[model samples]
Target chain A: MSAALQDLDARIVRATQGGLPRVPEPYAALAATLGVSEAQLLERFAAMLADRRVRRIGVVPNHYALGYTANGMSVWDVNDAQVDALGRQVGALAFVSHCYRRPRRPPDWPYNLFAMVHARSRDEVEARLGEIRALLGAALRAHDVLYSTRILKKTGLRLS
Target chain B: MDELDRVIINRLQGGFPLCTRPFAAAAAELGTDEATLMARIEALLGDGTLTRFGPLFDAERLGGAFTLCALRVPEADFERVAAQVNAHPEVAHNYERAHEFNMWFVLGTRAPADIARVIAAIEAETGLAVFEFPREAEYFIELRLAA
Candidate 1:
């Protein structure tokens, strides 16, 4: 619902999307580049985080490198009337990282709810899926897990 | 990864202070020194133990648009099609999964309209139907994986 970041705000995204510099005074360093006071930059960052323009400002461990080898996109066909409510519960589960309700392309794809689950192995992931299955109960019509075979590309954000 | 590394990964997943000496403040709570904490984070990022370490933007909240799109690229055409699909800068992430609609990627655009444009371009370039999955509602999105 938000509009494009403008002026200095847009510059901040372009500069720091890759990451903030790892330094004792990283914000000060960044502010210098943007020709703004450190206090000004911090204020903007705080506002962005509060508004969810910036989701978070911290570690993003690569699941593969951290031994979380099993990653599955578990999709479910839930009753449309109950999808939003059910999605909230599925997303609250400990193992579900990301969850959403999306339009289903009937005949080809019937899943309207998607949840990403990760674990150390396939068995572990399946067990987690079982938990989701139990949670959805009768509302869960069908489900499938799309296990990623390879990361063809994972380039970072591009400034527009 | 050692115990300390694990602690860092689990502890600093969010709420990393935005102060002048943010690492120092975080280190105090983690029972570690700032130098050690900074070094650990640098090493983690350098070796790909961590994919990213900074502000994670919500493109939608920033007036940008994003969509998860998929296409069923046949075995013979995967590699070639992958290259073609990746050629579009809008495609932020592309992955091959074990499903009929095996090729999935996330498209990020500055505006909502740009998303459809990118999808059309990809469909034209790949000669395949682009199945766009735009989220109707996004639930809680907390991704803190214990390392």
Candidate 2:
């Protein structure tokens, strides 16, 4: 990408990182604020979506407000050889929101594959964890679930 | 929240139209008029049902990096340490979990090299070891929740 194009993209992201305006013509409103044509703004947005720089443009619901009070980060110590394959299967589950392969800091953190399980209550979260445990079978070496007691900050990805 | 509100939240989680009149376009598919749909959304936001309603950007995809790090803060100063950690712009998310490594946060920087520097700064500022759990792979990610 050219330096000029990169600069333009960065400016747009920095402007909207807080969020797109909640107005009738949000795109036009944003364009007017940035002093760019509505068409140019839309074109850049489309390109960003295509490249996945912008994941999606929509509402981010507060699960806790909607009764999903329990959020668990369930980690597993699956065999490294089968970790990728197992991670894929675990990720495919309906209840798991985010799943990933993270390195274990042995003796302390022995979990390599991590998955987020969210629900309305502890029982629901436990039940969902059980489903994952059953799927791992003998391959599951060890596991633990860490529940967040509080959210200190959650300002996701900001541009500087 | 009523059935219409739930339906609106479920459907509008993503793929909101980017047009001159997005509410009008989106409301048509939800079987509601533009004015009513806009009013409901405004109420939802005002009442704190929806935290945010807009574009979701990926740090890595946008020429940046993200790293998940955990800190074991002494019980006597959890809040103080959290405030210091969150003071940095790189600390995107900081959560207090029920574990020995209670303070967990994610560091997202525009440049990949900034991650190490921030970790060092945190360690120096708090005098606590920073446990960095860099993500090796992402199997799946879906941020939508039923209302």
Candidate 3:
């Protein structure tokens, strides 16, 4: 990455956590507030997207109010060889909004394939999992589903 | 600002309002027509450029309370636990991070107490220790895939 891109990367991360401007031209407004030219700001934003410096730029909705009352995070244990393939398949599921695999840190923990699913009720989420499990067949290993009691900070990504 | 891009970004956030003729409202604000606005949004979503054009709800406020939680799963059972967790409707997002408590997932429940109950259930079902890390202090990370 170029030095300018590296700097833009840092700025983009900062922007995610920072307050978003409540205006029509939010990006432009953000640039104005930060004292950068609107064109420079747009270019940087565009560059970040092009280089994958930023994963996505969009509003994250509140699912709870939208009848998606049950929000659960589930982890799966899959073989290392099949992790990426499974992750992409799992991530692509409409109900499974976010899915990825992280290194196994264990003693008591043993999950690898991670996915989040939302629904109107616990039953709904469970049903979705059943479908996923059935789809995975033998590839699907032991699993644990954790539910949340409170959200401390729904929005934390700050833009620098 | 280029009128087109400005309109795109402005309508992209907070979602298009839910109502008949929602696009028209957005277009009016952008000094354009609904047909054009709708077409653009459709294109964006189809191209994987935009994640979703829907409501970004605040889980806590809506009543499905949640917290950040993790577990130290045995490497062998990782897949099982993940499937079990994802099966539950309450799990919002589950992520694998670089830490001892490698498996991280967020839970949203109708009642705050259900969060603990659900964790306990998972532990009992999976026979694994769920290292529950309730938020000590809120940490926010904004990750946006640029288009």
Candidate 4:
């Protein structure tokens, strides 16, 4: 990675990992702390975004607080050859939050395609899974929902 | 949430502008005042409606490594094992899912090799096999929750 992208300007990550300030001029406030001009900070941010270092700059709402209490990790057993294409389809569904293709350990774990479905209730999640099932169709040989019983720990990365 | 709250949640999901007065700019677009907009955001975050508000970094892109790992904790030992696994600083998100392989968590480390080291540590600590499922390919990843 280029120096601009390497380590992602540690100062910025360390300073803003918790969050950017909530002030009217939050960037300016953050730049002040980092002892950099607002323009320089924004320039780095833009570069980070362009290089896919920063996924987004926005609010990450608490799904549970927003009534999306039921979160189901819907795992699907898809044909290996067609997993990528089908995974993309499953990922595009409106209700799916995160979708990825993972290595499946046979006998013990046969599911390869994983999509996270969040909804207000189990029924809603089931309904959405049904939609995903239809989308997967033949590619989806079998599937199961691993509903989250509890959140053991949830926090952002801590770069030591 | 009230109408104004919904407006803020929905609109801000896309992005917050980078400007001298971003809240003011957003308020102008949403037809609200800067103070009210800022206040609403603070309230939302304070009340746990918003979990986070800032730039979402890609750990891997930043010269770090991350992996989704699972552990098949025994039903009777779930709590104990979870505590042991979560004690590690590298473990970011951990959840108890209703399945045989019930415990799932994401591990992030500054170096790629630290992933195995962390998993080994967790296994030794919990005496449970850590099933590491690093992403072979990312089909999609978007964390937009519509209000």
Question: Which structure among the candidates has the greatest DockQ?
Answer: 1
The TM-score that candidate 1 achieves is: 0.92
Compute the TM-score of each model's chain A versus the native chain A and list the values: 0.92, 0.89, 0.78, 0.91
lDDT digits (tens) for residues B1-147 of candidate 1: 899999999999899998999999999989999999999999999999998899998877767788899999999999999999999988899999999999999998888889888888888988999999999899999888888
For model 2, which pairs clash? none
TM-score of each: 0.92, 0.91, 0.52, 0.92
Writing each residue's lDDT as its tens digit, candidate 3 over A66-100 gives: 35778777777877676677667777676776665
Candidate 2 per-residue lDDT over residues A83-108, each given as its tens digit: 99989999988778889999999778
- Going through the candidates in order, their DockQ values are 0.75, 0.70, 0.06, 0.73
Tell me the spans in candidate 1 whose CA falls farther than 4 Å from its real position: A1-5
lDDT values of the candidates? 0.90, 0.89, 0.60, 0.86
Global local distance difference test of model 3: 0.60
lDDT of 3 at A66: 39
> What does candidate 3's lDDT look like per residue over B1-147, in tens digits?
245744575445643433334556667877887778766666655554454553333334323566667777677887787788767666777765445465767777767788889888888887877766443222122322212
Interface RMSD of each: 1.6, 2.0, 12.3, 1.8
For all candidates listed, what's the TM-score of chain B alone? 0.86, 0.86, 0.70, 0.86
